[model samples]
Target: MPVERSRRLESYNLADYDRLPQCTNRRRLAAGIATIGPAIAEPIGRRANDRLPFPPSTPVGNIVLKLHQESSGALNTITSYGDGYVAINLERHEGSIIVMPEGAVIEWPVSSFEALAPEHFEALVAAAPEVVIFGSGSRLRFPHPRLTAQLAKHRIGVETMDFGAACRTYNILMSEGRRVAAALLIEA
Candidate 1:
């Protein structure tokens, strides 16, 4: 019988790792870091010990990986299909991993700006749009001034708000077909 493939891989830029085999059934873990290429190999290998609790066959595409480490807690919530599955550190720590297909509609609630890295910020900026809004989780503190200044220089308007409100606003705007993106850091 022939196997069916999803549209997710249709546009995958395998050009970067053309040498990597395309076998879907190959055990991702056994294939080791070599299969994922140099750029993402190390990070993915390091996290192998904490692989997602779900079955390996779970389909993932266009994932949004968020990392959070706080004194209060560490949690990882993977949201997809309008549902979230959470994984937490049992020893009073928290971490989470969320994997969703590209173009999955989501409303994320965030409270802090520190969860995201510089690469994430750069990608958002390069997208270039009329406005860019950030949901700073529940906190009202401003983002690094340098980031704000960079956006201003590009003539893009920036807005910051609490995580819950940001999620609601981003959803509403997206539903209206607006060009928008958000970085939210909600508790697990």
Candidate 2:
């Protein structure tokens, strides 16, 4: 009779009572306990196995640029070309720019270029672009007096260059149609 009903359900005592835990037994107990309380809970189970979370920020819109060619080492790699092109990976300690646009990925933290006053040039002239390059990564500087009087009171037309001539003049004025937008500062 099914081996005496599996030896009477394995001799039955299943810890007497307190049941409700099995989601695969709470994934083998070792993530974020919900039960197993008290009894010196082993220093709260060794500080919940030494805490570990942050790893979920990476979602914006079409993006793909991965070029970490051992400039020092640590940018892992992920290249296959997506839309535009601003791929440069050099890490001996740090250097990253992979804004691949096609599905998702926006990692922009260029290393050396910081001079945007006038409340960051009036919030980049209220994000109403028509032309606003400004790589200044490789260095050329010039944009302070209240961000040149708020881009001359919203006449928005600033093009301070360097980061590879401001990424080739914002990709040739976005390929001759114009409506450009770039604010780089790469080199870490």
lDDT per model, in order? 0.46, 0.47
Q: Write model 1 residue lDDT over 1-188, tens digit each, in one string.
A: 99998665444554635445654433543354344344444565436534453333444332333445433222222222111222122221122221121243233323235555444455556656556657554456567767567667778777787655655565556545566665544445
TM-score between candidate 2 and the true structure: 0.22
Give per-model CA RMSD. 17.9, 19.5
Expressed as tens digits, the lDDT of each residue in 1-188 for candidate 2 is 35544333233345742354322333333332333333225564446434422112222122221224333233222222122334433222123342211222234444444523455445556556676776655558866556557766777777787666776666556545555556655555
Q: Can you give the lDDT of residue 83 in candidate 1?
A: 17
- TM match of model 1 to true structure: 0.38
